[model samples]
Target: MTNGIRVSVVAPVYNAGPFLHAFVNSFLIQTLPGDSIELIAVNDGSTDDSAAILDDFAREHQNVHVIHQENSGWPGKPRNVGLAAARGDYVFFADPDDEFGGPEALERLADFADEHASDVVVPKMVPRGDRLYAQWRYETTQIDADLVTCFTTLTPQKLFRREFLLDQDIRFPEEKVRLEDGQFLSLAYLKASRVSILNGYDFYVIIHHPQQDHLSAKPVDPANYIGSVAVMAENVEKYCTDPDTGDRIINEIYFRKVLANFTNSRVATHSLERRQAWQRQQKWFIDRFITTSRFEKMDEIAQVRTDLARDGDLDAIVAYARAGSVDFTFVSARSKRGNIELAGKLSGGFSDGELPKLVVIDRNDKSRIVTIPIQLAKSQVTVQIPKETLPLMEGARRYDLWLSPGRGHQNRRIEGPDRPFSLHFTDDRDVELYSTKKGNLSIAVSRGMSTQARTKRKLKRIIGR
Candidate 1:
C-alpha cells in the first residue's frame, strides 16, 4: 500500500526449490514503501524443499504469504491457488522457475499504468542469454478496450487489474490441461475495460525444466493445445458481441497459435491421433468464415513470394535487395575538406561535413551490428566517411560487415583499415543493421585474394615502378 494501490504478485511452485530463494529474495529485496508490493506464493505440492523455502520467506517477511495445496497434476490448478490469495488492487502472476530480470520492472509498470490510466500494462519479455530489452517511449504502448480487438499477437506480458479479474470470474479452465495461458488471457481481455500493451523493455528470465511443456521430453500434445484453442474460439464467437472483432480474434487463434506454432515446431512425426485431432479441431474453426478473394489474393502472393525467396538462395536475394529505397544524409566535422560526393550510381553518399553513425561504429574499434534482420533487395544508398570516425588506429586489425540475421554472421570483411576505408555501394536489402561497439576491422569475407597475389598487387599499386 505504498502508493495506495496494492500490487499483489502470485507465484506458483512445483519442484522449484532450487530457484525459490532467488525468486522470492529478489521480489522482497527491492520492495517499495508501504501501500506498495506484497507477494502471495502457492507451493503446489512440490516434491522437494520448495515448501520449506516458501515457508522460510513468509516467516521472515510479513509481506510474504504462503499457501500449501495438495499435489495436483493439473497445470492450471496451481495458478488458480495463487490467484485466489492475491489481495492487491493489481495482480501479476509468475511461474516459480522464472523470475524478474530487474527489481525495477514492477515499479516502472506501476508508474506507467498510473500515468496512462491503463488497467493492464505489459512489459517487454526477454529470454535468458540474450541482450536485455531496450528502453523506448511509453507513448509507444498501445491499447484496446476489448481483448479481441488487439492487432498485435504478443501474449501475456502484463499486470492485470484484480477487480477486473474477480468481476469477470476470470479463472483458468482447469479441465483443459494445456494452453491454459492462452485460454486465461483470452477470457480476461474479453471482459477487460481497458487493455494496454507496454513495449518490450523489461526482461523475464525463464529457466526451462523437463516437466514443463516448453521443454517437454514426452511426445507432442497437439490434442491438448487443440482443446485450449477451441475453447478460446468458442468463447470469442459466443461472448464477444462484435462481429468484426470476433472474426479478427478467430483469425489470430488460427494464425498466431496454430499455424505459427506449426511453423516453429510441429513436426511430421507426431502420433497420428494427435495430427488427426488438430485437423478435426481446425475444421470447426474454419467453418466460422467463408473464403474470399481479398484475403486469398494476399495469402497467395505472400506464399508465392516466400517460395521464390526460399532461404537457400543468395544472389537472387542480392538482386532482390538491390532494389530497395534508401536515404543518405551526411555531415562532416571538417569543412572545405576533400569533397566527398556520390561516386556514381550510389548518389546518396554523404557530403563532406561529418561522419554517419555507421562509420563511427565501424572504424578500428571493438564493434559490430547485432540482431539486425536481413531481407532481399537493397535500393541505392551511399555513405561518406568523416575523419572523426577513424579513431587513431593503435594495433588495429580488420574491418567487418556482420550480418547478424544471416546464416554466416560475417557477411563481408576488410582486413586492416588503412586503405579502402570506404564500404560503399553495399547490398543492404538483404540485411537489417543496428551497430554495436567498434574495434579493429576484421573482414572475413575475402573478395577472392591470396596472400602472395595480394602482396604483389599491393606492391604494383603502391610503387608504380
Candidate 2:
C-alpha cells in the first residue's frame, strides 16, 4: 500500500529513557510534512520508561508507530523488524541516542534522492562528542559518488530506497554480530545503481552521551570482532566484480580494523597473552586481504606495525608501540613574497637512523601530495614553501601538516598554537594556520578580503556614501 509517507525512520530503541524525549521531538518537529514522514520506534525489550514514552508518542502522533520485540542484545534484529514494517518510499536508520541534524534534514534528503533517482543518499553527519567522522567526504555534494572511495563511511545512517533494498534482498545480519553495518552497507553500495552524497547541510548528528556507553564502546573480544570483519570482507569479495575494487575494500578494512589496533594505547596495557591472541587473529585477515602492492601504499608506521603483527612478534610489537610515540609543537610561522615558512619542534624517541621529513597532505584530495624543502636539525625542523609551490596549491583549501620519521618510520601530526596565525601575501591572498580539534596543525589558504578592503567597506556602510 502506497501511503502518503515519503520517508520511514527506523530506530531500534533499548533503554534510551534519558535521550528518548529529545530524539522523538527531533522527528516530531521536522520540516517535512507530518503526513510525509513516519517514525518507526522498535522497542527491543527496553526495561525502562522507553516503551511508555514510545506508546505516548504513538497515541499523540499519527505518524509515530511502535513495535515491541524481545531483547536481541544487538540492534540487528530490531532494525530488521523495523525494516520489515516500514511503509514509505525511502527508509532511514537512526540510533535512539542520536537525532536528526536539523528539522529540514529529512525533507532535503528525500528531495535530493527523488531529483537524482538515487538508490542511496548519504547525508552530512556531524559528531557531537569526541567521535570523529570523515568530514572530507562530505565537503561537497556529489551527484554520483564512487563507492570505492566512500567505503570508509559504513554506518546505516543513510537514506535508502526501500524498494531497492527489498529487490536486492539486503537486510541487516540478524545475529548478534559486530560490523553488521559494514556487511549490510557493502552489499548496498555494490548493488546501488545511483548513489548521491548531500554535503551542503548537516543531516545527521551523532551524539555521545557522557553517562551512557554506546554499543560500539563496549569491550569486544578480539577473536569475535575479527570474525565479524572477516564476514564483511568475504561479502565484498563475493559481490564485488572488479578485482581492483575488491582489493581496495579489503585493504581499507585491514588498515582500519587490523593494523590500527596495534597503535591503540590499550594494546600496550593488555597482558602479553591477550596481545598475542589479538595479533594472531589479525594475521588471518592480513594474509587473506592485505596484498603487498596495496600494503606498500600505507603510511610508514602502518607498514611496520602490520609486518610485525604478521610475523607474530608480540615482544617487538609491544616495544615498537611504546617507543613510537612522537610529539610535535608548532613554534613559529611567517609569510614573505608569497612564500610560507613553518618551524616546529619534534620531541620523541626516534630510532638510530631516523630522519624527519615534512609531509603536506591536501585535505580535499587525499591522494595529492605537495612536497617542499625541509631542514631538520637536532630538535627543530624548518619547512620553506616556495612561491612557485603556492600556485600549485592555489585555492580555498586546507592542508594537513605532518612530521614523518624519515623513510621507514611513523608520521606524527604537528600540533600547537590554540589561536590561529594569519598572514597576507603580496597578491592579497590570506593564509591562516590553526589547530584542529584533535590538535593537529593545518593551513588554510584563501583569497579573502584584505584589512584595507574591510575598512573601506565598513566606512562606506557608516557614511552611507
Candidate 3:
C-alpha cells in the first residue's frame, strides 16, 4: 500500500553534482502536494558532492529519503534499491541529470494513473534544445496498438503502479547490465494490464551532455555492446511467449533500435579497427536471434545497414552514416499544375555533386522517388511529389523525408535533420500540415486550400500575371 502517497520519484545519483540542484529543485517545486509525493534519492557512492546534496534534501523535506551505497558503476542497482524502498502508489524513475519539464507534470501523471487505474502511465519526454529521439505517434490519450509498439523509447521514466510492478516482479537487472532499462521496461509493457498516456504536455526533460555514462564521447566497447544485445535477446524469449509477437519485438523493435543507435550511428564514429571488432561481435548475436526472413521484413534502410555490418562492409556504413546526417530544410510547397512542388536546400557538407534525390517513404516503407532538378544555386534543388503521391500521402497522414544521393540501385537512403512533412485534411476543403508527435517546427502554407483548389489558384495567378 502507498499509505496515501500518490507518486514516488526514484533518481539514481552518482557523479551528478553539477546537475543535482536543478534536478532536485524541479521535483521539490512540483504542483503535486509535497506530502503526497515521495522522493527516493539513492546516492550510489558518488565521488562528488552528490551525497551531501541528497542528505541536505532529506533533512529538509519530510517526503525525501536518501539511501547511500557503494558505486555499482551503472544505474540498475540504485534503481532497484529505490524501487524496494518506494511507498507511493505509482513509481517514476528520473535521471539525476534530467529536470522535470513543468510543475504540473507530476500532478497530471498522478491524476491520470489514479483515475484510469492504469498499470502504466507514459508522459511525453522532451529533449533539451535541438536534440531529438525516435518519437512515437500516439495520437490519442490511449494507444490503439499493443504496448509493445511503444517500445521505441526504453527509458524508465514513465509512471508504473507500485502494486503492478511488485506483483509482476518487474525489476531492473542488478549492477552490471547495460541496456537494463530496455530489458526491464520491455517486460513491464508485456505485463501491464492497462496503459495510459499524457500527451501534448512535456513531463520530463532529458539533458544530453558528453560526460554522462550512457552518452560518453568515447567509442563503445564492442564486446560490451554485443553483450547488451544478447541480454535483450534472451529476455525477449523469457518474457514474450507468443511466437509472432515475440518475433516482431525481437526483429522489428529490439533489432531496429540497436541498429539505429549503435550499429548505424554510434559504431560509425568508432576507429576502423574498433568498428571491425564491433561488427564481428555483433554478427554472433545476430546469427543466434535474427533469421533471414526476419531480416527481410525490415525496412530498406535497416536491411541495408544490417547487411553491410554482417558482410564486413565498412565503406557503406561510413557513407550511410555521413550521408544520413545531411541537413535538408523544406523551403516552400506549392500545388503547381496538379503536382505538389517542393523546394529545399541541403547543407551539412552535402554537395550537389552527390546528386541528391528527394524520396517520399510511405507507411509501408515503400518509396516514390521524385526527380531533382539541377541546382538553382549551390546545394539547392527543387522536386515535385507527383500527382500520384498525393493520394498515398492523404491516406497515410504522414510521409518520411529521405534523400538518396546519386542515381541507380546503389543510392543509399540518407535522412534529413528535420521531422518528415505530414498531411492531414484540416477540413473537407483543405489539407493542413501537422508536425510529428514531438512538436517539430511549424511549416507555413496557404491555409484552407486543397490540392485541386491550390492548383487552380496557382494557374489563375499565372494566367493573370
Pairs of residues at least 3 apart in sequence or in different chains that clash in candidate 3: none
Q: lDDT of candidate 1?
A: 0.53
Of 1 and 3, the candidate ranking higher by lDDT: 3
Local error of candidate 3 at residue 365 (angstroms) = 16
Better of 2 and 3 by TM-score: 2
Give a tens-digit lDDT track for model 3, residues 1-465. Answer: 468788999998888988888998999999988989989999989998999988888898999899999988888889999999999988999999999999999999888877777888888888875456544644557733355566667789899999899999989988565567887887787778776666877889988866666533444565775676667667777767676777777775545545644423564557888777767776776777888766766666666667766787877666666665555566655565655566677764355566566655553445544444424465566776555554523332344445655421224343232444434342322333335554432222233455687778899999999
Candidate order (lDDT): 2, 3, 1
Query: What local lDDT score does residue 65 receive in model 1, on the 0 to 100 scale?
Result: 87
- After superposition, candidate 2 runs with Cα above 4 Å error: 291-302, 330-401, 406-410, 418-465
| Candidate 3, RMSD to the unseen true structure | 7.0
- For candidate 3, the 10 contiguous residues with the lowest summed lDDT are 408-417
lDDT of 2 at 388: 57
**Shift of residue 144 alpha carbon in model 1, Å:** 4.4
Whole-model lDDT values for every prediction:
0.53, 0.82, 0.70
Ranking of candidates on TM-score, top first:
2, 3, 1
Give the residue spans of candidate 3 off by over 4 A. 143-145, 209-218, 261-269, 319-354, 360-369, 373-402, 406-465
Candidate 1, position 64, lDDT = 87
